[model samples]
Target: MPDADRQDATLEWVERVATFCVEEWGLTPITGRILGLLMICDPPERSAGQIADAIHASRASLTSNMRLLTTIGLIRKVRVPGDRTAYYRIEDDAWEKVIQRKIAGLGAFGDIAEEGLALIDDANPARTERIRAAQHALTWLRDLAARHPRDATT
Candidate 1:
C-alpha cells in the first residue's frame, strides 16, 4: 500500500479504538483519542504536546487527562535523562490493573451490602436471602480474582 493509504488506515483504526473506549469504557472522547494514538503511534510513546496536537486538544486538557491516566495506572510517565519533557506510554499491565480495580470495586459493593443487611430487619427472611446471595456472589468473584495472577500483557 502507498504510504498515504497506510497512514489513513492507521488513523481509521485510531478512531475506531477511540469510539470503543468512549462507548464501552465510559471514557471521554479525548481520553479515548489519547489511548488510541498511543497504542498505534511509532516508538509507543508520545509527549503531551504531540498527544494534544494529534487529539486536537489543548495542552491543559492533555495535562488533566494524563494525570487521570497515570493515577489509574493505565499509562506511565517516562522521563529521558537529558530531556525536560515527559513522555507517556501505556503500561504493560494496564488492562490487568483495570480488571483488578473492577474486581476491587465489586468487593466494595459487597461491603456496602453487608452494611445494608445490618440495618435491615432480620425478620424479613426473603429480603435477607436475596441480599445475601448478591453479597456472596461478589465475594466469590473477588476471591477468584485474588487467586489469579494479573495478566502481564495488555
Candidate 2:
C-alpha cells in the first residue's frame, strides 16, 4: 500500500483499540489513545511532545497518563545522555503482568465471599448457598490461573 494509505490504516487500528480500552477496560480516551499509538508507533519509544502530537493530546494530559502508566509498571521512561526530555515505551511483559494482576485480585473477592458465608448461621446452611457458590467459583479460577498448561505438541 501507499504510505498515506498505510498511515491511515494504522490510525484506524489505533482508534479501534482506543475505543476498546475505553469501553472494556474503563480507561480514559486519551490514555487509550496514548497506549494505542505507542503500541504501533515506530522506534518503540517516543518523547512526550511527539506522543502528544501523534495522539493529538495535550502535554498536561500526556504527563498525567504517562505518570499513571509508569507507576503501574505498564510503561517506562528513559532519558538519553545530555538530553532532558524523557522517552516512553511499553513494558516488555506489560500485558502478561496485567493478566496476572487481575487473577491475583480475584483472591480478595474469594476472601470476601468466605467472610460472608461465615456470617451465616449453621442452623440455616441454605442461607449461605449463594456466597458459597461464588467462593467456589473464585477458588476454581484462582486454581486455574496457578495450574500449568498442557503441551500443545502432545
Q: Per-residue alpha-carbon lDDT of model 2 for 6-44, expressed as tens digits? A: 989988888898899899888888888888888898898
Report the error of model 2 at residue 97, Å. Answer: 1.3
Runs of candidate 2 with Cα error greater than 4 angstroms are 122-127, 149-154
The alpha-carbon lDDT assigned to residue 14 of candidate 2 equals 85
What ranges in model 1 sit over 4 Å off?
151-154
lDDT (C-alpha) at residue 28 in model 2: 89
lDDT of 1 by residue, 71-90 (tens): 98889999988999899999
Let me know the TM-score candidate 2 reaches against the reference structure.
0.86
How many residue pairs clash in all the candidates, one count each? Answer: 0, 0
Which number leads on lDDT?
1
